[model samples]
Structure formats: structure tokens, C-alpha cells
Target: MKYDVAVLGAGMVGVCVAIHLLQQGRSVLLMDRNDAGEETSYGNAGLLQQEAVRPYEFPHEPSVLLPAAFNLRLDVRYHLTALPKLIQPLWSYFRHCSPRRYESIAQEYGHIINMTLACHQELISAAGAEQLIRKVGWISLYRTAKGRHKGLRTLDAYTRQGVNFKVLNGDELAEIEPAIKGHHAGGVHWQDPWIAGHPGQLVKAYTNLFKQLGGVFVQGDAGSLKRSHQQSWQLRDHQDTLLEVDEIVIALGPWSAEITARFGYRPPMFFKRGYHMHYQYPAGQPRLTRAVQDSEKGYMMTPMDAGLRICTGAELGLRDTPSTPVQIDRAEAIARKLIPLGERLDAEPWRGARPCIPDMKPIIGPLPGAPGLWCAFGHGHQGFTMGPATGKLLAAMMTGQTTDIDMSGFRAERFKKP
Candidate 1:
């Protein structure tokens, strides 16, 4: 059977893309090697992050870089073997972190970030996924007064861009999140973001909405995709053609490059590995009222249906590297100093990769050399938060409509002439 479009990832991004295309009068098939939302979409700190106006930058400071070089920090770790392959993209990432370039990039990124809530709100309303979302924004904790002052200043600058936030004294923070142990200074209560109590379930709800809207989702592989002489894209399983489509969108997240490489659009996409594990608080200790991120400690503690989840900082490891969960332990140790996170919920931590481009922006438009082929990936740490926005922009581009935001910055051809 032939379809108008097939999206090749069933994660939050692909599912939303299919939903949007279907809404725009396209017969779309959402394909993936695994179930929807069970991969990278499942693992996140669970914030919609409307206040994350700035793109995550690689630290150019010597004080931060020196310790991180030795893997001494809890927030970042790297795989020694991955460095050789990562040199080029990592270098570009560093270059883009320069103040002037990063500032310009953040302006463009904020255009997308600003739309995240409206986009996701539309999906949540359609899917009836309101129960999975907490409108109460997360809290950012700081230990030292100096850190709090600097952080508040940075946040104050963001406020001029129309972000909403509240400054909390140490006591106020303690009053709101009583379980957190000690804090000398204060924190920023980001009042604009939404927390996904269960990020994976939220994706499933959207997928269910896709099914209700008559969008097809199936198990398929892009590795088996090809353009027939008739100029149609076909997905295969084993020796049989699973389906054929006139157009295909590669939204395979971290694995996007592998397939795009075959089509001559391999972006300099590197992976940042992160881990999370749930823990039950001891009796009498209050559970997390809202998601809280300890900026100084480089971890996030969030409350969800499963339990209180402690998420680790970024690990600059190869995508294919075996799971190294050392960060979870370190994060848990750091968290216990503040809050009482009791027994571990899962024996093994959940790990996922964040697909990052050197310029700290996602690619979300047509594949240059490959006609009838589109691309959307490289959302980095904010994919979970911005998936719907990305989908909306891509679907509009795919259907030849004016997008909500400018599409030039996110084109797949930005890396090279491809």
C-alpha cells in the first residue's frame, strides 16, 4: 500500500510529526524499530522547558573545562574512545559556544522554545493527556550565595525576553520543597514551564491520539528503505516491502545520521548520553512536590508516578558504548545530602542519547540532495520539550505552507552543500 508520507521514528518527535501531517490532510505512516516513546523519549528530566531560552552551550571556561577533562565533575563525563570520532563535531560545538555566535543561536532557538507550550498544549488537549502534566514549573537550586547571584542575573536577562520566573530565598525554597535538605542561598522558580510527570506516557497518549485520527503506526526499519525507480520510498522488513510512500521523513533521533548518511546528508550529529533511576523516599520524608534541579550538583530530582527520579548530567560517550551508570550513583549521593531518596526503584538505570549538532540547533526541513525525503532530528537535550513544535514546523514545510517560525535556520542543508 502507498501512503503520502511515512515518518521513520515513533518517538515523541515522529509521532507528533505524523499527527500534524494527518491533520494537514496527509495519509502518514509512523514507522519505527521499537514501540513509540519507549526510547529516548522515555528518559528525560520531564520539563517542557519554555524558560530554557538559551541553547545548551559547551563550557569554554577553563575552570569548568579542566576538571571535566579528567571526568572529575558529576555533571559531565566522557568516554575516552569516543573522543577520536567526536573531535570534529565537538570542536564545532565549542566554536559555536563563543558568546556572539551563541547569543545569535539562542535568539533563533528561543523562537522555537517559545512555541513549545502552545504546540504541546494543543496535543495535550487533543489527547486528553492533561493528567500527565503538571503546570507547576520546576525549581532550580543553588548552594552558594555567589552562584545564586550569578544565576539570578542570567535569569533576569532572560526575563527581558518575556520569560516568567520567581526568585526564591533559601527558606522559601525549603517551604515549597520541604524534602530538600540544605541550601544557603536561593533558587529560581521557573513559572512558565510544564513538567511531564511521566514523559513516556505523554508520548503514548499522543500516539493514541494519532491512531484516533487515523494515522498508521508500524514497526519498520529505515536501513531497509530505498527509492524505487518509480521515485517512491519503500520500507522493508525481511524480504517483503512493508509499505511504500511518496515522501519519507527521517526522525530517527540519535540513529538519524546512520540512515541520512546513506542519502548523503549525514550531519555532524554527536550523542550526549544521560541516565536516570527512580528512588523511593523514606517514610515521613516528603515526596517531591515539583521537579527540582540542583544546578551546583549537576542533577535533577523529579517526582513521577514511578517514584522520585534522579537524573544525571551529560556523559559525552559514544552512542554505541555499553551503559555506564556511574553518574546515577554519584547523582544519588549528591541528592541524598539534600533530600532523602531511599531505595532504588529499578535495578538498572535507564539510559538514552541526546542527538546534538555542533551549532546547538535542530535540523527540521527538506533533505537537500534527496528529493521526496525530509529530515528532522538533532534536538539535543530539549527534544522531549520541543518535539511537537518541531513536528508542526516540519509538517508545514512538508505541505508547502507558511510555518509558525522561520524554517531557514533549521534546514538539513546547513551543514554543507548536500
Candidate 2:
């Protein structure tokens, strides 16, 4: 069946785009290789933080990466097995690691991060999933005064960027979370305007709403596209099922690299697979109202209906591989250190790989050199946090509506490396 738009992914970003397009009275066919929202969307920390702090890179990143690069627990390793030719991307990363570059990138990210929380509230309320959201706040803990000092710089940076945070001492930290161990010198209590509900459920609600609004979901793998004599391109599924669409959105997460590779536009994308373990709180266990990050441990503990979840940094280069014994062990080790409500925690581990762009910013605009093709991937760690706002902007741009925020930095053409 002919559709007005075919969204080539059912992840959070793709589903949100489909919903937004449907809201604009456009027909949409949302396709995915697996169950919708069951990938990165399902197994995330589930915090909708619109902290507006800064990008992952900063001016001090060189110093930070030097030490953290070797910390397996931190999940920031570089692969020596890659070919020598990979130096270009590595060199590019090194150049961008400078504080000057980070400052510029962070400023751009701060602009978009500020818009997500409001977008989240509007969308979640419209979807009727308010119970799944919590605005309690987020905590960042440090085991040593040195870590606290590092965190202080971050706090200062955030403050300069218009993000406010409350500083808490070790005693106050214990008072706030008695279950938490370690005599942290101090910590920071940051207000994240954008907090999250159950992201998986939210995606389901959006797609369901879209279908209810007459949007179609074609459940199959989207194959290559070809231009028609009439100028519009035709999209096909794995079974050779041809469908015509006026426009298409390529929001296929990590798979976008493979999909675009066929069209001679391979992105410098890789997977940073992360793992999270959910536990059922035992009776009398302390409840964490907000998400907490163990700075030294390199993981985060977030509250959910089942219980609190603990997740850690990316496991580099193991994108499509199944969760290994090592990955699960590392996640559990970090969880055991951070979460206070884990007495009856289950042993099961949940894992997902996210599409990571080297610069840590998403490619969010019209597809490079391809008319009627748009990109919305490489969000890395912020897909859940940024998906709604991105959808609104892209949808507005597609439908000739005015955008709420400026999006000059997220141009997909940034990586025009042939």
C-alpha cells in the first residue's frame, strides 16, 4: 500500500516520528526488524533528563579520557585491533576532545537539551503515561574528594550553561539515601526538567495512538529504495513488497550504518552495548525516588515499577553480539555497589546496544544529498531524553511548520566524509 511516509525504524525515535507525522495528517508505515521498542528503548536507565548541561565531551576530556580509557569498569576503551586506516576517525576524535571544541559542542547540545523536558511532559500527558514519570531529581555520587572536585567542575559548567544543582556533603548524602554505602566527600543534586516514564510503554502508547489515528505499521525489514520515473522513490520490504511514499525517515538506530552503507553513505557509527539489571525491592528496602549515579562505579540506579535498575557505561565494539558473561558480571558488580534496594533483586540481566556517533551528537536532519530522505540517529546515550523534541522539530520541518528550537549543529551533512 502506498503511504505518505515510511519510518524505517520502530525504536523510540522512529515511533515518535511516526506519531508526530500522523498528527499532521500524514499516512505512515512504521517498520522494524524486531519487535517495536524492544531494543535500546526497552533496556535504558529510563531518565528523561533535560538538564541542559553540556555534551559528553568537554575541554577537560583529554585528561579524563586518558585515565578512564583504561578503566574497564568505566567502559571507555579503544580497540587496538582496528586497522591503521581508522586513525582518521581517531584523530578527528582527538581534535574534538579539546576543551574549545567541547565548549562549542556543549553549547549546541544545551540548546536542544533544554527543550526535551517540556516536550516530554506534553507527549507523556497526551499519551496518558504520567504515572510512569517522576520528577524527584537526579543524584551524582563520588567516592573521593577528588571525584567531588571533578564533579564540582561539572557543576560549575552546568551552572554557567544555566543548569542549577544542589551540592550535598557525605553526611547529607547518607541521610538522603541511608542504603547507599561509601563515605562520599559530597555529591550534587541536579534538577532534570525532563524525567522519564516507562520508555517502552510510552513508545507502545505512541505507536498505538498512531495506528488508531489511521497510521499503518508494515512489520518487516525495509530494503533499499529506488527513485521512480515520477521523481518519488519506492520503498520495499524484505519480502519484495513494494510500497510508495512521498518521504522517508531513516531512524533505524545502530542498523542505520548498515542500511546507509548500501546507498554509499556509510556513517562513522558503532555500537556501545550497555547492560542493566532490574531488581524487586525486598520489604523494608529503602526506596529511591530519583535516579542516582555512582560516579566512581560508572553506573546509574533508576527506579522502576519492578524495582530499581542499575546500568553501566558502554561495552565498546560488541554491538550486535549477545550479552556475554563478562558484560553481565560487570553490570552486576556495579549494581551491587550503587543500588540500596537490592535485597530481593532478580539475577536476570537486560542488555541493549545503542548507535553511537563518535562526537556523541545525533545526525538529525535531511539525509545527506538525498532529497525526501531524513536522518534521526546516532543519539547515543540521549535517545530517550531527546527523542520527543527531535520528533517535534523534524515533523515541523517536514510539514512546513515553524520549529521551536534552532537545529543548525545537528545537520546530517556534518559527516560528509566519502
Clashing pairs in 1: 181-338
lDDT of 1 by residue, 1-418 (tens): 8899999998888998899999999998988888889999999888899998898889977989999999999999999988999889999999998989998899899999999999999999999999999999998898999889868878755876789989999999989888877756889999989989899999999999999999987886778898977899878743365687999999999999999889877799999999999988688878778898889778898898889988888999899879989989988887887888789999899999999999999999888888998888999999998899998999899889999888798887789652
lDDT string, candidate 2, 212-248, tens digits = 7788776677665677677676876767788888888
The CA-based lDDT of model 1 is what? 0.89
Task: Supply candidate 2's per-residue lDDT for 59.
Answer: 24
Runs of candidate 2 with Cα error greater than 4 angstroms are 58-72, 78-87, 193-197, 224-229, 236-241, 325-328, 337-348
Note each model's CA RMSD in angstroms: 1.3, 2.8
